[model samples]
Target chain A: MTVGRKLWAIIIIKIFIIFAILRLFFFPDFLNSKSDTDEGKGDYVREQLINRN
Target chain B: MIDQIDLSMVDWARAQFALTAIYHWLFVPLTLGLSFLVAIMETIYVKTGNPEWKKITKFWMILFGINFAIGVATGIILEFQFGTNWSNYSWFVGDIFGAPLAIEGIMAFFLESTFIAIMFFGWNKVSKGFHLTASWLTAIGASLSALWILVANAWMQSPTGMEFNPDTARNEMVDFWEILFSPMAFNKFLHTISNGYVIGSIFVIGISSWFLLKKRHILMAKRSILVAAIFGLITSIFLVGTGDGSAYTVAQSQPMKLAAMEGLYEGEAGAGLVAFGILNPDKKPGDGEDAFLVKVQIPSLLSILGYRNTEAYVPGVEDIVNGGYKPWFEKIPVEEKEMTYSVAQKIEKGKLAISALRDYKTATRAGDSILAKISQKKLQENFNYFGYGYLNNPESVIPNIPLTFYSFHIMVFLGFYFILLFIVMLFFVNRTTLEKKRWLLWISLWTIPLAYIASQAGWVVAEVGRQPWVIQDLLPTVAAVSMIDTNSIRITFWIFAGLFTALLIAEVMIMVRQIKIGPKEGGSK
Candidate 1:
């Protein structure tokens, strides 16, 4: 492959590893994981804010 | 509703985020600035119809590609970190913060990715004018991305156009345009991008100097030096101007950060700017110990830079902590009579705000609209000092003095050095004896790393100097973290450390190999 093609391949691989694999396994979105609805998320945040303080 | 916070967990999460951010920053400035340099070189080639210029452009473009590919999406982890490590901070200001980031994704990312494809592969496939346009668009895309991100960050420093919604428990954008056109945003974007420009110029000239040192591509080296030195000279000067603007903004919005940067403990009119100083390790707030053990200063310079008036009062750490003096400028939405407050008073007000929020929530749940309105009004009155309520000790408001002070001085000193270096380079590049100046060539090559150091130092000053606060007065760093296991964050921190180190090693090796290959002979179309 040309150098540009090889670099592009690396980039694509990297994006997949970062966004697809690592994100799924390691870095779950906290609010989304805890609650699917906006109201639920707001309740969670309020509870955390008031109770934690 | 955990009563006790795992402070260790918060600290570890902070470390992880800092580690990722530091790593991500290593590549971003280069991408931000080098794209434009490459575009400019391509423009010259198109204008002159010179194959030699085309070869130079291609050579630099390949280096730019290597950097862009390796650095791209490294910041993806940083964004994810917001969800994983700082979930509360994400949800709290996400309404205000997420807008710019979303815009950045939709506008800048697509624009950049599209044009970059054409710029890289369309050399002979597309018309020359079209190819040049793609190159310029790619550069603009990178800068536009920076603009949105910087606007978001500037909001953190001097939050504007945002209102606290007790119902959602988040700061929501009330005026998007105000947030976009904030004074801090303007200064930060210009200063940060100019720093990138200076770094890009330094990289070009430094690498070109290496070629000259090895007695290879002498003509190309000279030509690159001529263009880069002039570019570097202009941007470095602009960097100083923007730095001044930043200092002034910090003085107005974050007096404590300014005081920490100067290592000042006593308020004064006509405060001298510390040119160089060593902090007294024994110094503590209100202890009357000398703030600086030894120092040199430019008289009244700090006052002038900060307030644009030589006699304007510049408060120090003690004054900020004790807080009796009236500020020259205040941005917080508070009653005019309540403008001055000690840290202790602010903490009291912040606690009131928190209590009012709790009451508002409870009242809403109990269907008490009248009580809810009363609580909401109280919360707004005290909300400016809301983050202060979380602190147990008033002095906790002070950031790390020594780190902030030293970083500021080092960055300032380097700014002057860069200007001088560019001037010398511009002169020497025109002279016949340029190639013979082996010492100067070595200095030029060494400057590449120094430029990176200066760039990093600027961030340290900005970030560390505002310590303990995630968003100026609204959220404390300790309060902003996710409730996660400390050991998990610790493990991830090391994982990132190793991962980023490996990436850095790979990038350096690839860059050096490409440099060894050098530009193509007789140039490519």
Candidate 2:
């Protein structure tokens, strides 16, 4: 292959790798969970404990 | 007494953290080390005018693709679990944790993603310079992601740049820059990223060595090994340095963790660093009973690491466990106890009230006082705080000691080994004798497993060492979990496990197939 074509290939490969990484790492809300809100579901339990005391 | 509820919360949170951390790491190291390898490959192609270099880059890129996909898939669940499993923790510390995550999204994610698309699909369309820029951007993005995640994690360990807000019942950021640049954050970030680089390099080296052994793609394999070795040497050296810095930070910020890591049991000046010991926590150290069975001590190491002096006092596990904070539960005053109890009760009562009100409204609309009364009685029953006692004293809270202790040691041992290995590799490569040695090739290959083991160990130590604390000294892990049934946790766990397993298997299969085909064919494709 010619020098330019080899250069083009190298450039293309690098771009592909970069794009793949970006898509993988750029995820928003990556570590946040939906079930976390369930703790808020049982406020009555706490209120009852306090009232009893 | 720290009851079962507290301990179970810790166990649950820890299990979740461990599962996510182990899976996340399986992806991250590859990202770090592979990016640098690709960069080097491109550089070689530019410098040496070798099309084979281009071929090598293409081959690795394919493996990177598979790993990247699995990494992304496994990684997304961890974020969601923050809300799902640890909702109270999210409410309490999300103000602090969310900042870095936001920054990670804005600063690293966008830059990485934008350029990555151009890089991946724009091969024939985009300019050479633009594509190279994209490659560097992806590396920057990966490193940046590590930075933000470490910043958040370090803050959890040391809790800097944030103050408690009584109104929100949470810790909020006072200064974003302070949290970002905190000593622990910086040290941990450097240590983690360097480890990632080591993992990436070792992965390349190991696979390349396998290719060389098979006499497949001889020139391509040799060049890949040489590149991997160089990257590995540099990264491994830095990994050790950053690890020392991390140890120092841990000593200062969490003396208890340091004590646990070393398996020390007494307050001692000029303490020896234990190389290996069966830690009998049951017996007191230096009671002349010899609690450390077959103790091997490197004199003055612990003292130097902890206090910057060989004679400074380093508190041991016994000191930490016995001194003031013995039963962590007893430390909470009545007011804080009342507040927590009240909040939990309010949440429970509110849920019941809402459900009862709904049932009553439905019964009244249907003109049925009997049904309404039944719903009212059920609501009243649910409103009772009889279950609160159970919440305070949970069942099924046991420490998995063997796993915890071994994981901690594996991480520490790997840290030291990588330091020595990297230093030796650097010396050999600098002396221009790197290529002539077949053993270095083998060592580099073996280092792949070490990289993975080290990552796993670090995570195990982080999650397991913080047993009983989801928010470190504040919230227990069990209390942080969703009130979902055990069957729910089991089902979700299995489903996640199954899906992740499938993805992982597919990833390995793709990588193996690519390696088998060799880079020469890969490049032409």
**Maximum-DockQ candidate:** 1
lDDT of 1 by residue, B277-389 (tens): 99999899999888888999999999998988887779999898888886764343223524468999998998899899999999999999999999999999999998888
TM-score of chain A of each: 0.80, 0.40
Interface RMSD of each: 2.3, 12.1
Give the per-residue lDDT of model 2 (tens digit) for B127-151: 7667777777888787897788888
User: Model 1: C-alpha RMSD to truth?
Assistant: 2.2
Which CAPRI tier for candidate 2? incorrect
> Best candidate per TM-score, number?
1
Model 2's number of clashes is: 44
All candidates: TM-score: 0.97, 0.75
Candidate 2, which segments miss by more than 4 Å at Cα? A1-53, B1-13, B281-289, B324-405, B419-443, B521-525
